[model samples]
Target: MKRIGKWKDRLAAYVDGTSGEKLDQGVICRDDQCTLGKWIYGEGLAQTGNLPTFHQVKAKHAEFHVNAGQVVEAVQSGHQDNAHKMLHEGSFAKSSRDV
Candidate 1:
């Protein structure tokens, strides 16, 4: 995955529940399909297989100001090891206030 800079804003809108029509814009992928949308809507993975792991996903959520419910959803849907890593070593672990 590219640096988190690209899809940051779109993911923020998604977690904020204020995406509105921007929800149609999707994540920034080579095929223009929305990776986050697939996860949020349970739409299954895109053909490209460029899925972000739980740590990366949650880190971006924190970095972009995502909400608590979205964070919980990420943990529920994420890989166990990735979620563990985020809980133990990533931003999610550091920001007790956010949790």
Candidate 2:
């Protein structure tokens, strides 16, 4: 969760013009690439797939990535304000909590 929070912070920095790290929408769109995602798809699924909440976690995790990618798309399109807003209180923020 801390790593995931840092990922969002990196995007926020990019959108704020404070960091030079290049944002990649394509990469952010792949939820399964993150550590949490890896566990969800691998050990987590194997260990807890039968749990009722497992499916919800999986779905929310996927949505979080989609929301994150949308924020990156806004940034890449020259919409820093929109991206920042998203990082704070829009789809991105919602997913951050949901996930």
Looking at model 1, residue 75 earns an lDDT score of: 41
- The most accurate candidate by lDDT is 2
Across 1-99, the per-residue lDDT of candidate 1 in tens digits comes to: 342433433444444445553332112221212454445334333433355664454444444333322333454465445544543455434443332
Worst 10 residues of 2 by lDDT: 1-10
Clash pairs detected, candidate 1:
none
- Show pairs that collide, candidate 2: none
Q: Which stretches of candidate 2 lie over 4 Å from their true place?
A: none
TM-score of 2: 0.92
* Residue 27, model 1, lDDT: 28
Task: Score residue 41 of candidate 1 by CA lDDT.
Answer: 34
Show where candidate 1 strays beyond 4 Å: 1-71, 97-99
